[model samples]
Target: MMNLCYNMGADLWNLLRTGGSEMKLLICVLNDTDKLDELMIKLAEAGVKGATIINSTGMGRTLYNHQESALMNSLRALLDPDRDENKTIFTVVDEAQEKAFHKVMNEVVGDLARPDSGIIFTIPVDSVTGLSK
Candidate 1:
């Protein structure tokens, strides 16, 4: 189990490190796929530089809403390591240009105050190795 866990972690790290200092993960759960493309364009305008995407689904039959299903689908894709939705865009941004990154996310994503805001999140990376542009 330990070795399995290590290998899994390594694989995930390898996947993420492919981008280097420009490593920023963007998980946006939205209702409209078109909005995603629009958001991508906006990100470009905001200087996001580059991104990767992964599709996802929710597992729970019932929740506050279907958002969980979307997230669950993403988790499934992550596990399979072969499938992903173009929806979960993995954005890579350099630390020197995070301002542009946030600008992109806020400009494109819908209102978050609403109960169903379709959240967008980011995960910063400390160091990257064994990967390239």
Candidate 2:
């Protein structure tokens, strides 16, 4: 079983690294939901043809909302509970476009390094079958 798991993991890694086309899956989680529209526009301007967006909540926010601990409740109160939910966007783009994509994201999202702004990351895509232009 261990060998099988290792083999599977290795295969997946290899596939992602050597995918037919140098593709990357970019994911962005935005704390400010109002920016979604502007983000989409920026993405389009950056040459992203397709993407998916979903409403999501962070683990910390979820715990703060559901847990009954006074500490968690107090933390939530301090953090402004209304802005806990975020929008997550996923898009597949050619690896060559990474720099432009990031530039556009920064311009629209205002430096991911800042707290509570959001997070953006990328993963190599091994294969994409049904993506249309």
Candidate 3:
């Protein structure tokens, strides 16, 4: 089972339908930037209409690159001569599409429980404007 880390309650889906707020904001921090294209393709196949990607680097990468310590800098230079920034993807999906989204994410990125894989999470969207149906 996928660990979503959030409890939307047992009647969450029903509440979403009745409350007229079935939309959820799904965010994913993709560590392996190389897999971005494949992930996008799989997400489209899984019914995600649109998503936004931001080029971002984590704190560790930032420190590794800028740290004054010669030892850490030397290690960084030796280990990762050319490192890429992570891709942070954001999308809004309805209740039904949320499951498909997670499924495809796992399929593309593998088990997130593994180290350095990636992270995916969702937040309830109360209201959305400027979005097309």
Candidate 4:
């Protein structure tokens, strides 16, 4: 169910093991920016360099903290009606930094990856490239 949208499509093997950073193929469900800032500050205190974010949305409901706005619902019919308010973030992150990212999410966001936290999981780019850059 992992939708890997790559800028350049090659043989399926390339997707199995991501090495280099591609344009924009991987997905990431980032936590709240405020919490993210706090997380970064903590990481900064710990000597982390930096990180980035992309304004994105997801399909499920009650799956993330940042719910889908009313406007987004009108724009796309992909949301689940019966579920709680539509909220979930989609994102991409570095594979090597996966554990650290999750640690931040768990400590800062508290259940960001939980089923009803309204935030899904961040994906790794096996070979991401050309992410609308």
Model 4 accuracy (lDDT, Cα): 0.46
lDDT of 1 by residue, 1-133 (tens): 9999988887677556553354555556654455677877777776666667666543322242355576876676578543222255565456544666556556666455565435667686544553235
- Which parts of model 1 are misplaced by more than 4 Å? 1-24, 59-86, 95-97, 129-133
User: What TM-score does each of the candidates earn?
Assistant: 0.50, 0.70, 0.72, 0.38
lDDT for model 1, on a 0 to 1 scale? 0.57
lDDT for each residue of candidate 3 in 18-51, tens digit (9 for 90 to 100): 3564788999999988899999998888888899
Backbone-clash count (model 1): 12
- Model 3 reaches what TM-score against the true structure? 0.72
Task: Judge candidate 3 at residue 104 and give its lDDT.
Answer: 84
TM-score of 4: 0.38
What is candidate 2's CA lDDT for residue 130? Answer: 67
**Compared with the true structure, what per-residue lDDT tens digits does model 4 show for residues 1-133?**
1344433445353553344433222233543444555766664454333445555444443354347676776545456432333223333444434555556557776875465443445443455444321
After superposing candidate 2 on the true structure, give the runs of residues whose Cα lies further than 4 Å from its correct spot.
1-21, 67-82
Which candidate number would show the highest lDDT if scored against the true structure?
Answer: 3
Error (Å) of candidate 1 at residue 64 is: 9.2
Name the candidate, 1 or 2, with the larger TM-score value. Answer: 2
Candidate that beats the other on lDDT, 2 or 3, i.e. the better one: 3
